[model samples]
Target chain A: MRPAEADGGARPVKEVRAFIASRGRAPASLLDRYVAGFGLVMGAAVVGRPIASLLGGLAGATDPSRAGAGTALVLLACAGYLALARAAGPVSVSGGDASWLLLSPLDRRGVLARPARLLLAVAVAAGLLLGLGLAAVLGAPDHLVWRLLAALVVGVSATLGGMALAVLAQASASWQSWVTAGVAVLVVLALVAASGQARPALSAAAHAPPAVLGAAAGAAALACGLLVRRALAALGRIPARALLAASTRAGHVATAAVRLDPGALTWIAEDNHWRARRLRSRRWPSLPGPLALAWQDWLRLARRPGRLALVAGAAALPAVLAQAGAVSATAALGMVGVLAGALAAASSGTAGARRDGDNPSLARLTGVGRGPALAARALLPALLAAAWAAAAFAGLALTGTLPATSWLWGPAVAPALAAGALRMARRGPVDHSMPIIDTPGGAIPTGPLFWALTGLDVALIGCLPAVAALLGGRMGDGSLMAAQALAGVAVLAAYVLRARRAR
Target chain B: MYESIITVTGLTVELGGNPVLTGTRLAVAAGEIVAVVGPNGSGKSTLLRCLAGLQPAGEGTIEVFGAAPSDEGPFWRRVALLADEPAWYPGLTAREHLELMSAVHTGPSRLTVEDALDVFDLRSRADAPPLNLSTGQRQRLALAATLLRPSDLLLLDEPERGLDAAFRERLAGLLDAYAAEGGTVVMATHDPLLAAHGRQVSPATGGVPA
Candidate 1:
């Protein structure tokens, strides 16, 4: 038995923490506390006006046509929040603490107390935002303050309960299934709301009296309290192995964030996912040399059918936003969103290109010319981007935002998206040596700004015709569509030829 | 009579203003196996990299295949270099990686995918991703991928790393077979047994044949 067990038990958590603190950095000074307080005050001052304006806007009845889509978006956001919480361990420590303190025979509850508090703070903050969104979606017809308070209570309760479920899921297999079921139910509810089937019920709840709202709020708070208590009690029961794995993942994420290298995070996530999976080797098809090298990306995509479905499902988000009156095809924000989504879909298949850009050892072993290899690799990304954009455009047509023929623009713009994805993958690390430009707004570091804009510039230039058509409300312009197709193909072909010349 | 595959005269290299190799001379013929053996930080790997055209020599002349070495696809097509543990293509099994190697090089591979798996002792773990394999198994997979592809010259850095003693002996036999097929090899190694299988040379002695 361990020495701590040999004794009566582990020391009090407070005393252990105190002992550790003594050997660590000096305590925060008065000036440090003052700066922290000032920063918080400044942040609140900056954010307070928009929040108040939003709440003021929520005081009246909402548009009935937008209610369904708004409700669906709110539900989807909650589901996404819960899923992200589960994926993130919802309970993880820093690298130093996990390595030095987690494995020791100390009080496990004490060891995890800090992360638990952090999770709680994050959940609370997210719950507040969710509450505001919910209030906005289901506007108050009477007693606006009381209705808003009830919404806040319900939102906080739901998030706290979901977070508790995630925590329990990490410690036990059965709870994990429950959390999965909960997310699925939320998604189904979102679909039901989006379909307008729940319109009557949503309308009734939006105008409900203060007494009814207060009772519901009280019940939600009681349930949230119970789940929070249970989660707190179960904190010490979490397995060390699970904790270690989660902590290591968090460490990688922290490192990536600190270094401002978002590229590393994708590899970290990919390596971790494959490390746990069991794969069956299949015979490689007899293809040309460069095509053979590119086949790995197709195989990778095929292996993750769930991710494929998720990407397909995400294609409807633009239409959903349009339906909710949040954005329009003619708006800059909406166009940017559609283009960015297509680019992201395309980038999902460019992992092979990214891997080669990061490390050329495997590429060298393959012995394929860079230009041919890149051209071959672009095919999958183009297909993915085309399919995703087509689906999105079809959704927009259904929403009456664009003509039915707009779907043809998807394939027209796919080559440009593929080129952008490939360029983004090969952009390498953020060069911190670039000059920082000062503007009236703020000082912008050109390195990260340039890194962010590298692929986007190419994509924007290639898609200029489509962008112009959309912004000018000329969706039926056949000439612009043909121009988009020509521009995309020309850009991709030029990029490939340039790569050949560069070699 | 043998054709000269590589030649270096009075090659000097410095890193961070420190001399690692100075006035090194070496000559290698086709179908020959030459092992660069030396202690740590003695420029063994540097010489191998220089030969593979990956590292630039600070001064002096170096030639491979009767031309200055270049890092390009055509150069790599004729020369295969296995230095560090390569970043494995994500989501690919060890066996599939070997299959990919065979598919990319239209020329006949030295070993079929199945034969490479068996020869490298990775047959049992063929379906496992390289990330899932132990250090030794991953190293074996790397070696298998390197050897399965067709190349005129093989540059291996620390081929014995993470391999069992038994596997190291097997690696020696594999290298010999590769040479027998008229492929040239220049390797950096610390394993005496592996080095003994070739013409051992040390960078410390200005790359004179030992």
Candidate 2:
């Protein structure tokens, strides 16, 4: 055997074997990470559980068992969703040392068994912890041991089943539709029914007697095991070359003709992807700069859905709490909408910039004929802020809270946010090694993207005084307000464009 | 004398038709670690980026490793860059950084980022987040990760900015050793002592080729 062939030097192999091997030697590192994860989970549970409990109390502190089942379903559903998302259509066994092991002395199925085998450790630990928690909660320490242990197994199985089904279901277009349909059904049930009434449909067994709960958990776990096997089976069928090629996001887009001026920040943003594409110059940062990146960022931000929903609630909360039924709901919501827009814009500005590392060098490698990428960086947030603020305003306007005379100021607030955000958008402290998080479940890109969005929110807040004056009809009416907003956005967009070009 | 691995002809960089670099030209061959030195805003990094096919020349031609600096030259795969504080996912560990890179690489082999870390002396705190590490540690980690990949043309922007003396010496030796293996390197630096390792080309305007 060649020495070079056997020696993997300088850089560790990114293969599953190498990754797993690193875990063993770096005992402290992995353990520390797990500890951190544990701390995070516990901390979140501690802080979050009480708030959830309080909210449930407001609806009626009805049933702890029901609440537990509901919480489990929600948590497990999110995990399932992530598993499906990661599967990306599930043609093969992805994780563990399958590829390298298959090539080694091990049999195919045996090689694939490592990731599958790790489930026991997971089940044992999770079961013990959960069992302890459940026993403590119910004051049933005598049955706690068996109950929690069984619950852990059941939980794992349920998640695994959901994950497997999600992976397979994702192959069909209707799966997303089905999930959407189910979520809609759940949401409706939540809004209309009493607390936890919808939970039983999904996790009823956990709410039943001790024996029933244990059995339910075990059965759920068994289903999850089946899912793991199905995923494994589906995985073994994929072509190796196809997997390898797909794994590396390498392709040259010959038709990807994007031109931007030299030495511009637009050029910088485009150039980053150029670095990302090691072997293919055919693909690069689109000539339009960060515009494409911005839209994508926007789409992902929208997917959270929580952002918009929160704004709606913020606006709605004010009106709902209002004593005047005539003025109760929508009116207060509008004022809050205006205020919330300001808050959102302020916070979102610094998203992608995260100090300053998102600066010149990080972006200096893409196409640079048109400043579209930079334009997108500036515009998408502005548009998104505008859309969001507008939605907030729409809610308020519907509620009869927004002064009709001043309503024109809503869109104008967007430009104000973008302008202020761009000024603050200048890079801060620099980080040398932040890899882009491609998936939402992966670490979110927390720099200029967030900052940009927040900046837009700031503009919304900044424009409020003017919005009030215009809406009140004391200053200018709709036309004057609209013109002012347009001018402001134009000015902000221009400043952002100019600054990026200089960069 | 060495055969030229890089050459630039009539290169000019412009913004909105205003010249940042007008009629810029340079050339260097194999087994050379040429330092493109200049004061701030002298277009030193721009020239390297153009040569690396990172930034397009407004008016010029470039070649690397006998091939023009096209975006996807074999030279690129064989090249690496130590950018000035590049972006990173704050959540990723150093090992994850190399893992991700190796995952996307095109080769029949493995790349171990650990040795590069060892060379930079970052093995102990490898799993530590770069954001929490000292500036020097982060820089070394970035440089180590880049060096982990095989490259012949290396375009570094102040690659030794935050390093201590030992790491600096190690870097110069690493460059020297690579040149010993017929690799060509172009770097931008502010240190005159380290600049002595290579023939110093003033990256600023108003300098004629030696």
Candidate 3:
């Protein structure tokens, strides 16, 4: 700890603190121009022409199916918004922002207000756009001017309502989370039960006069103002730990969405559940390391009722469809084949595969290098997928939809799908460091590796059809087996190439 | 009967475009313990990582058992590394993590999950997930995981990190026992107690003489 050395070490940290003190951020000029350009583009090519066409089409057409479909879309969007708010908390600051900005001696209100205002604006804009899109689809443009105004009013109201819920969740996490979840679940049930009925609340807003709609909009705005005011006040008292946790949760949610693994969402939600519960036990049943690891992964996945239910629900879909006479047993099996592969690929039960790259030490220590490591992780997901495929195919066989040979495909395809998934999980989010690619319009914040991985993942899905075609077509076993061997080799080659790049 | 297990010749490693290890050379033999000692940011951990094959050598070469370090042959199967920041799954308990290591590692160790939990004094919180574990507890669990896997060569970065004085002494005892069983160890450490037990290799000064 020489004085000069200490000073040298401290210099970068000092510079960073000074930079934060200045509150200097990137120029917003480009963002402003981009927003304006978007508005102009929408006005010319999207909003104007679509509205006119919708109106003309509605006037000529007799069926009101479009309106019903529009209503469903709006309801689905509302459900999605509520779901996001419930899961990801309202306000978030990165680890740096939490330390440098939130915990700093700056005016907390002023600092929080900036992002709050941006979020409010974005929410309102998204709501308005969605409403307009719905309105055009519904072809409810009899009083075109007033109808659009009404749609805007409804948008403002719904957006504000969602924001108020989000803010409340941020302010009081435990209570707000539970309450919001209950309300959301109830709303979903009610909507599902009365799905076919024309929604009265939505109908009134669509047909309401400008003055009445404006009054409703004004009331919603007032509610939002009150909520925002209270939320900002609460922010001052909110723990730094809570904010950090929220930020981490938001990051997980964002990453999970990108990865398209609903199971990852379960990981976040269940983590919160575990933290909240803090259940402890000491009962020990010793097993070998590898068996124990697999057992643990299975327990982690199955213990979360929500996740298990979701997976089981996915598995049950084809059976439900067949029972409902929506499709024949044969069609159900075909549908199940594709969906099962997808669900298998998407499942995060395979912890070894997903976490192997992130923890090279574990792999090195355990002597489970890439291929063996991936196989170990993929075992559970493959079994689960195979089980689901088997059940679905059995139904088809019982209904006399296929020969007994169809059962063989499940064992073969599930493992292949699992391998593909293991390949995808081999690269974690850490491997995808955020690198901004500069474009003429703006900078795109994404890793080049992410784009490459995404392309490869999609291409992997494309290879599934070859297997399917072989199974369903009149190809002989020798030729079909040869084709399968070639495909397997090709996949193995790709996996090896990916591993080399990773190194 | 002494045979070199790890040999690094003119090794150079750059992390984030900054050279961490430059023209560093070292060798460690079977059943021997070597300490890679250095001040902070002096490439002790980097050298260990290179030896364990977790890091790619920017220049020169690294050989473990007379084979390229990067090669995933039988040599790698006999090697184990405990990294600086030990990784544990968020959903897994400390005990479960050990169980997982037990399942994945098929080398030679006869360490049981209960034995590890008892040794680390993690019995109380064995069922608690990583989110609940303290920094010291996490480090202990990581060491416990390493024990679950039997290896001929062990590379540990800051083995005594986040441990108490008593635990450091215990760790020394454990390493001594491991060495008595004919295992080779290379630890990146600042602890004099741990360092004294090994042939000190200071890579900052271009490595120690074999």
Candidate 4:
């Protein structure tokens, strides 16, 4: 046995004692100990017969095979949540205080261990509660309790595995947070949906034969969780909070040190990595220096996963939906791209305002006049639009709905509305919310311009086919009209300037 | 005493329908780096912002150049701002950023983006994305970019904040040089050293140079 595993696999007391003996650690704080006890007791008793019956009869409800399906579902849920966390862990945890925690006396492993355990226990308890509810509601038969028990156990593995994916992603800064959860759900759901469709017997979740089915799910979950755990360990010490000293890098002159701005940290995260990755000896009959700038944008586009996904969805959806004889994939994709950006832009624009932080002078800077700078400043939402566009297209294609003749008009209309949205974003003492969370009456601060963007987008759709016809892009029907209208918008945007605070 | 180059008339600001900065008139002139001394919520930053064109004045006139803000179209090209908090595009490199800025200008008279990079000792980091640069480096970059602007008027809010003595002294020298070259500078700081170097002080809401 491994020496670390030698102590009875560590009962609560033995674990604490070993830690204290070796490193002079204290027991859990009074609040923590009490919370721990509360959790353990809560788990052990809820699984006790009487409570389980009252809660979900889940413990008493299932046949073994049926229990297996539920076990898979629970694992699926855990995995979903974990992936959500890893993808979008806040860049600034509480605006940068968490980074400071690294310097405290707490060792990283020891510090993370309790929280991870607590999370694990919580996952199991949640699964148990869910299972019990199902049993109570469905009047599950007696043989199913063992299945339920196994399902809960399996859930622990699923939760850890999913969470591990997220943690790894976040630590590596590999992807945007919003997409992380969506991707995880889509993956798990695709599996469950596909399998459930093919074999109805597998989804007879209330029926049960034995605990083996649940146990298999549990094993799969456990393996995935273990993988995530190992990945986190391999990521090494990030020391995210350790401020980069100017000395390590040139141009960090003695004259410019300030409290580490979170913005700077983000810049450092990209800048340092990029520099390290730069080719020491780049040789080429390179493209003209002036045009070379586009390569940077190309690289940026390639790196952004959500953007690619959105593009694929928008492009594919019409074809997919047409095959299924559904709604117009073109209209659907257009709306998706516009609305998502419309919603996301408000929040991002507000964030921009907040970061701008009362510095009205930035408006006065001549650099703000550049088309590209304006574009970059408003990029967060533009990409949101792009993602929406891509997804809409892909969904249409998948559903077989694309109008065969209207294909070429897709790229033209997407960017036309996008350019309009970009224009509106710039023209703000950016009208947004004081409490900018998404809620009733808490959506985008509504006004004239909001309606204008909406109207403009709709108008673009109305004219698409005409514009396509003018360009001779091809269209079988007048329905290609919307592309014509979107094409027309490009002209309006070129002539009309977006308003900003007067200098 | 520093003369007033930026002037605000009947300026008012509100947050969540509550007044944060009232119809407060203020002015700052060329060669003035005023340390806006204040306790935390005293509107020091808000005042700087009115001049910066960040937060809108609920009801007032802010003249940046010889014209009111409503005519600020040309005024923006000449202004450089370093917010109390840094602002950057996460995806763009430092060099790309300069390129973007240069695109807005009608071909600046001097200070190619490369020269500014060399001045700030940022040549090595020129290709580094803004997000990857250290705080000090980013701040220097922001300053260098701000300095490169052709606007005779310079407005820097809390520019010296969070800097060690070495960096702080270097900033003072840069300011002195800018003033010698006939540029207008309006820098806000809380540091006593910055105040002393500027030969003036302003209350959090007060605007007299000294």
- lDDT by candidate, in order shown: 0.90, 0.52, 0.64, 0.50
Error of 1 at B8 (Å): 1.5
Q: Quote the positional error of residue B92 for candidate 4 in Å.
A: 2.3
Error (Å) of candidate 3 at residue A155 is 4.3
RMSD of each: 2.5, 18.1, 8.7, 12.0
Q: What share of the true interface contacts does candidate 1 keep?
A: 0.77
Looking at chain B only, the TM-scores across the models are 0.98, 0.86, 0.91, 0.78
Error of 4 at B118 (Å): 3.4
What is the per-residue lDDT of model 1 for residues A265-323, given as tens digits with 9 covering 90 to 100?
99999998898899999999999999999999999999989899999899999898888
Quote the positional error of residue A473 for candidate 4 in Å: 21
RMSD of 2: 18.1
Best by DockQ: 1
lDDT of 1 by residue, B1-210 (tens): 799999999999999999999999999999999999989999998998898888899998999999989878898899999999999999999999999999999899988998988888888999999998999999999999999999999999999999999999999999999999899999999999999999999998998976
Alpha carbon lDDT of residue A333, candidate 4? 45
My TM-score estimates for the predictions, one after another, are: 0.95, 0.39, 0.72, 0.53
Query: Residue by residue across A1-503, what tens digits does model 3's lDDT show?
Result: 75535553344445555677688775579769887897688677867786566555543212243344455446556666766765565677655666666765454544455457766886787778666755554445356666665566666666666766676666775548644664566456434423435545545545666678568667866775776567666755556666677778877777777775544675567557766655443333455444444565567675666766656545534433333233453353455454444446345566555555555655556564454444445577667656666665555444444445545445445545555656655544523457778766556667644643642463355346434543465223445544554564455455645664353
DockQ scores of all models, one per candidate = 0.86, 0.04, 0.37, 0.16
What's model 3's lDDT at A247? 74
Model 2 chain B: ten consecutive residues of lowest lDDT? B102-111
Question: For model 4, what fraction of the real interface contacts is kept?
Answer: 0.24
Worst window of 10 by summed lDDT in candidate 1 chain A: A3-12
What is candidate 4's TM-score for chain B alone?
A: 0.78
